[model samples]
Target: MHRGTNLPAVGGYNQALILDVIRRSGEGASRVELAEKTGLSAQTLSNVSRRLLDEGLIRESGKMVTGPGKPRTILRLEPEARFAVGVHLDPTVITYVVLDLEGHVVAHSRTRTPVGTKPEETIRRLTVSVNAIIETSGIDATRILGIGIAAPGPLDAEGGQVFNPPLMTEWHNVPLGASLAASTGLPVFVEKDVTAAVAAEQWMGALGDLKNSLFFYYGTGVGAGLVVDGAVVRGASSNSGDIGHLIVDPDGPLCRCGKRGCLGDSVAPVSLVLEAIEAGLVSAPTGELDSVTVDNDFTRLLSLADEGNGHAVVIVERAARRIARGVLAIVSILDVDRVVFGGPFWDRASRAYLGVVPGAVADDPALMMTHPIRFEQSKLGADVAAIGAGCLVLDRVLSPKPTDLLI
Candidate 1:
């Protein structure tokens, strides 16, 4: 529970703090209960609750006769009081979502990322798509707080730019955040895709209850999102989760980074598809493989492995082992007991990877942690990073930090 201050000047902080507690309370909370939980005086709680009710952020649901004197009215969060927009810029697809204050996705859309297009052209498309989705959702523009974007990293987050990501060759030092903000006319925040994934898991998924965990993101590229001491870790440059370069297999595959068997090159969807092509399990495309082509081929490879194809099984098993090895190193370093798996490609590979990874990590002689590790697949599905991006807007507006009390 977040404690509230009696100081008069920080009323805004108190209001946000109270609103946060009310939102988290599923059944709603009474003024007396809130005061008890937040360590606020009855008068202070009453003032904050009145402000929230006046702003339409919270409502008096009904009267609850709990044990004592008069009936206590339940104060519940008004979930639709505000909205947020989330956009995920993937190498293959761009996802957009509109989220209500309660973190529910009210609307969503997906578009294939423009291949061989200039960043300026792509941003124009993004602007058009964002406007279209907002209009289609029937949401009042005034109710929207802001837009948040999740993108591939090596981001200049402080400067609101996206440095050239490995998969996105055309996007070099792109001012994505500023450009989107200028076009959309809303406050915009940019976050690394994996970091946003973990943030979404923490905000809306079961991971919120855990103190420490790792979100192993398996997308076009492989990365990890970290949660330590119940907080998402965004390192110095807001590009913390870059596990792709971890050397998992020394003799496996040559990476663009001039290294052999890097975790990303060995287990990425494209790599798996290429391996399948080499092994005669998949037909190689006649022309250069675009994102869509690689996606389709990767799906085919997974389907073949699922159908008991011996060669496909070997490839998947090997990839799973390499992923496990990389995960082991990370888990050893972080000492987190919980590991979550999700991303665009995670669903297709979950059955195979899940079957191998948990046991492999547990049985490894070099495993560092004595406690049993728990693995879970994200319930947010493929659009998790997008949803998380929206949550960033909501979190910024509603969640109260101790720093807010710093005077």
Candidate 2:
């Protein structure tokens, strides 16, 4: 809402670098602390902090307990001064959430992706929705950092483009980030929806300060978001946790990703739905459960299972078995403390996997049991990914990296 001071020379210690450190330090650092952490001189830290403080991105909190001399006024983020937009784009629909610095949603909006429609046209509608959200939220343009879109992927994260994800075929090479950035006049970051969820977990969810933990992301399709030592691991192209491709049965049905026996085909929602169809239960096709007239969201799936629909129970149980297998494989390789599951697919999956996941882990009789791994359901619930992606912006402005000194 107000200017603090001017920025450092563009090439010198910049806002991105300075903000990165403060974020990692929990969003507030004294001039002395920043200088020490970043290896920048006191004068440079002073200049940078001054610029940030004046910009209202950060604020001085009462005082810190300095040893003997003057009590130091502690510095912290002015979380309300800025905000981020998190867009969860699935084939089903687009969900937009606006998060303030603390990752709380200030406002929200939703729209359908218009199945089989042109990608450009869909994004145009998304842009309009973004505009509408900004207007409805009553947030200032300058206070908005950027939009983060969490889409189903096979993504080109650096190029900010979407590759041909199965459900979103019309979105081939769509420049989701650049287009939204251009239209919204704010920077844009694109991440796989599952990965975004994992990032959120690492930054703000149950993971807390753990160094290594795997997030078993159960959604329309299954995947994972890996956080190693506080960093969101990005495999060469920022799509590391495409574990849906893990082939649990090499002789199974062909996966949309073109691998027969891959996990997505073996355990994803459609597989469960098909199982219902085969048993004379579901007579319809698997579209977005919302788009269909079946009254299925996840609530319905669980309710059906609870009522003992023979086919539904069998399929859901089978899917959970496959998912448990995947989780076991992930833990064996990663050795994380706990495996946390969350997503649109989580409810029924909880019913399906809850009883079996721990058994699968324990059955890994191959591994030692001196300390067994634990499992958890996401407490953040359905909105974890959207909130986490939006938190990325605050992270960019708060967390610091070693590269700040080197780069």
Candidate 3:
């Protein structure tokens, strides 16, 4: 729990601290409860509560009687008081979501990502999409906090630049954040897609209660998002979760990095579709295999595996084992007891991967952890990363951080 100070200069922090407690209290909380949870003095709590009520951030619900004393008034958060926009820039798709103060997704939109387009043109289209979603949601523009973008890694997070993600060919050293901010006239934050996916899990998914966990993101590429001691791990460059190059299979598919059996190349959707085409499971497209074609073919491959096609099942099972191998290596090092799975391509592969991954991890001879590990599918669904990107805005504004109390 975050404590509040009565210092005059820190009133903003104190109000945020109090609101954090009230928002998490679910049904509602009384002044006494807020005081106990946040360690705020009655006078300070009263002042903060008045301010919150005046700002329409919280409201007094029906009174509740605890004992012989007067019934304490319950205070509840006004979720609609603030909103945020999150945008996820995937290699194959662009996802946008509008999230309320409570981190609930109120609106969403998705479009196929443009291929072979210049970075400037892509950013322009993205700006148009963001504006359209906000207008369609009918949210008060004044209530929006900001926009957050989750893109592929190798990001200059501090500079708000995308430093050439492997999958996004035209995005070499692009200032995505500044460009979007300029176009939309809102504050913009850029984060690695894997990092944002993990943030989404922690903020709105089942991983919130767990202190240590891993988010195994499956999309056009594969990566891991790490959380240790209840905090997302952004490494020195803010590109922490690139587990793609991990060598999982010695004789598997050759990767662009000139290596064979890398985790990413072995399990990515495009790779799977290509393999299926090679194995006569899926017909070769007349033209080049684009992201959209790969997406449809990947779904067909999964459907074939679901119907117990021997060749398709073998391909999926091999991919699952390769993913399990990569996951085991990380879990052994990080000692995280929980692993979450989600992303654009996760839904198609969930049943097959889930069936194999857990058992493979558990049965591995090289397993390190003595305790049992838990596996869960993301409840936030396919739009999780986008929702999390929006949560970035809410988290920045509402979550009480110790740094806020610095002198």
Candidate 4:
């Protein structure tokens, strides 16, 4: 779940709607084009455009000549007029991305989370990294709308605290949103990493137009994000997408959550690496493959599979089959028409997973419940969550929703 605030929803709603319409037009939009696309009256468009231009959120780029009339001014979004900071707080590392109004990553930085150190120290480091990017990128600080943090969930999003996230016990009830806001001198919002990634997908990914979809987040851990009726499903506690614990194979492996053959137990990075080692596909020395190296180990194994290692390919296919079962369950439960794969580890694993997962899903009996569901490999790449976090800020301030039109 992502909590957003400081929305200017009065006449700002109409302005946001027009801005979105202009943004979708790419090069620029004339007043007539904006009116047609946004369904606002010519007078309303004129009023809104004036206010937007006065606010510096948009500018007249040039003029388009017509056959029998005067030139029409083309309005374009001022990409530098606003900015947002996105952060992914994974257990192994923290990723930062700075996005402008157009959702481009203007700057990025990565740092290892000081897990062994105090929680406050990690927060302070996060603050420093965020400030550093803003300072170095040469973007005006006043233009930064806010900061969004994507952290592992099972915590309280509305309350802004992380509670007992797996493996990272040190971050318990850390009040991440408030703390980051206090340290950065900006409004902050916190979201589950997968949900944030889904936000990124909805705002800018290839499948952004889909109202119902599933995002399978394959990172250091496996989780999911669901979008139902064009809204990100956050569950009652904002911990909705914990699909990693869904039981996909009852007789296979014992999961840490006391379940037999959970999705996380089957295809999470650590599990994949371990499976590779057990099958002799990874012949690393003992004690070298531990908790700390699971990410690197999985990357190495995925590279092997990519490089035509037969045994490594077998391991990934097996994992893909298990993962497909999980995907089927989520799609059936949600009755969604689309599923997308993403997260940090997706690139390394996509070639194998995409090759196998779709066929497995297509063959499932659940396919009968919906129209032909579309499957896509995420184009958002490894920074999906980080980018989503930034988009959260943009969405809060700019994107027009039905509620915006109510009042």
Candidate 5:
């Protein structure tokens, strides 16, 4: 069962609201600042401050001597007061991260995922990994709030179940959240990996206070995460952001879903590697390039492209162009001003894609009437989804939005 209710305590919502205000005020805020920002009475602010202080959620950091009668005590969040665990499940890898109250990753671990592994095996492996990290971190178990899991979608997030993700065909209808919770004795919150990545950007990224943006997540697969009004946009079934199937090229290769030139089949790592191999860039002495696994082939092609291999560069550029087309279509329809490119693929392909994608979007005629769009690389690197998962835990417990209020 999901241990923490989405609806926070009636007073809990107000307390969380104050804490959020403090967290954003990195320089610390006086009680007056809290009252002014939160629109709560001075008396209410005092009561909340006292409770937060007694609970150790917030602490008086220092005194700000304004133009005035007395030095005002400034308060700030105590990041070490609580923690959340984030797990990112990808077809190629599984990443775990422990995040403090302020969304900084304190500890992390990564392991290669066994493709086609059964759900039970994957669950067991995940449980052990989660236990090991928490045990080694030396943080008191009670202070650990809960676990957030970011898994590849087409998932039933509300139900804590994973459906048939494109790459991981074996994970059909797995009760991931309930099973993990039962195994670890902790609340488990599951989200689509792409949506979770968007949450990370919204919670702590360069795009602060920007209400609308799209995250183009390129991992073992290609997907998009949408944010509107500072909340992740999940379509009615909680499985939106499945941009992989959007047909980018009618004449391109066939996707695994039996469609022609779907986005997933176009720029997915496996698709890129297969393209490289077919183009003669991934050849070997034994003609055994086929023996190389998907990740290895993809990494080799990206490495070659980075080293200025002409063939590899051409392949990357083509992939970037295809990706740009998809991005342009998305930006035009959604009218999102900020577009972020990220995931494990970002680290290696940033140089290649950045060279072409921004120009591609900028040159598009659709932008003549709209404000200039900003294209950025992800600041959180590969940990974006994992951190976002952790943020999901923190957001449920600490964010002060109206949805958390029980009217």
Candidate 6:
């Protein structure tokens, strides 16, 4: 008989493998297929499958034929076995996604987070929204792994605390995770939204199979998330990818980080729009940061540029060039081979960056000596942060380890 993976720190290697396999397979798989892929034996797979089934993690459907003897039973992940809550706390609005074990979003909910929304009120709304989702979905509370929060950077991921998050003012050293945990009575993890996007991309995005990869997340704010050697490179403070603070220009403009010429200050959407207006390139850039969500603005910018809007063209191009400079630095230093771009602002950035990046790198004497980096759209869709936030808990429950039985 095979043993169960319930050890501490290591988590459930078997469960993780099985769940991840199903997560990626989409249409689902059979026990024999899983066993073949994972190298787990028939009896061991049976044990694992039993536990998963008992916990409603998977369900048995019909059977498929291998040869002439007997039809093998098909096993699939029970999508509704459990639920995970994902919250995207942007500046003006709150988007919620309730995902089941199969990574299916059963219910989506959103609300406003106005200029001076209190932390306490936000937490209350979150709890109520979460409970309402569960109440509506009829998913038992016990089965909920917990809530995975995807918020802006400058946060302590491990501690679940916020530290002067760029967009959300009046929040410093706030125990975001702890407060949410206390209120909901569920395990809560607070992650930089960019990192969450990277996670989502890894399993479903353009970075798949690229172990050493860089994900440039451009949204309401700009940041980077790195997967070095197939592991999340959450630097010394668990806040490594807030590259928005990276100083790209020494004497350019003021940054939210109290510095001048930071890349974010140079190229973030807020900067681009403001610069366009100030340059008299745009007449009335009346679009408020909160008015157009990242997704919408990105689309609009792309459309405007396509329609021959000179101001939009310049604003987007400049941002793309600045982005290229920042990306080149990382690719050169890390010898990274892949770069996937996504976020609310990706549509505009993608079209513009595609032109700027290759040229920028090709012109660089250093990268010109090596193979060019590959840049592409996120394989993951718009709901990356929310999906990846849910997958975070799923990862904790499923990631592999060294001592697992291989065949």
Show model 4 residue runs off by greater than 4 Å. Answer: 1-9, 35-44, 65-68, 283-292, 306-311, 401-407
Q: What is the lDDT of residue 289 in candidate 6?
A: 49
Off by over 4 Å in 1: 405-407
Clashing pairs in 3: none
Put down candidate 5 lDDT per residue, 222-287, tens digits, no spaces.
888998766679899878888888887788799778999888889888788878978898753354
Q: Per-residue CA lDDT of candidate 1, range 1-407, in tens?
A: 67788889898788888888887888999999899888888999988888888988899999999787999999999989899999999999999999999899999999999999999999999999999989999998999999889999999766779999988899999999899999989999999999999999999855558578999999889889999998999999999989998999998899888999999999999999999999999898999987998999999999999999999999999999999999999999999999999999999899989999999988889996878899889999999999989999899899997888777
Off by over 4 Å in 2: 1-42, 64-67, 249-261, 282-298, 308-311, 365-371, 401-407
Give, for candidate 6, the lowest lDDT window spanning 10 residues.
Answer: 1-10
Per-residue lDDT of 1-407 in model 2, one digit per residue for the tens?
11122334442335656665555567477776766656666676677678888888778887777799777666776768889988888676577889987677888776766877898888888899988898899998788888888888799877889988887667778888888888778888888888888888776645466467788877667778887766677788888888878877677678767778788778766665555656766565555444433225344555677788776676667666677778778877777767788876675568567877677667765555366677888776767677667876666655543354452
Between candidates 2 and 4, the one scoring higher on lDDT is 4
The better candidate by lDDT, 1 or 4, is 1
| Candidate 1 residue-wise lDDT at 160 | 72
Per-model C-alpha lDDT, please?
0.91, 0.72, 0.91, 0.85, 0.85, 0.74
Q: What value does the lDDT take at residue 93 in candidate 6?
A: 60
Q: Kindly provide the TM-score of model 3 when superposed on the true structure, using C-alpha atoms.
A: 0.97
What is the C-alpha local distance difference test score of candidate 3?
0.91
Model 6, 1-407: lDDT tens per residue?
Answer: 12334333323577777777866676778887888787777777777788888877888888888789778877777777778888877665677788877667787776766567677777888888878877887878888888999888788889899878867886778888999899989999888888888887775444557688888887767788888888778788777786776776677688766898788778767666566557565455345545455335555666777677887787777677677778888887787888888775566557666877767766866564366677777865556777778878766665554465443
Winner by TM-score between candidate 6 and candidate 5: 5
Report the Cα lDDT for residue 122, model 3.
Answer: 94
Instruction: Quote each prediction's TM-score.
Output: 0.97, 0.85, 0.97, 0.89, 0.92, 0.83
Candidate 3 Cα errors over 4 Å, as ranges: 205-208
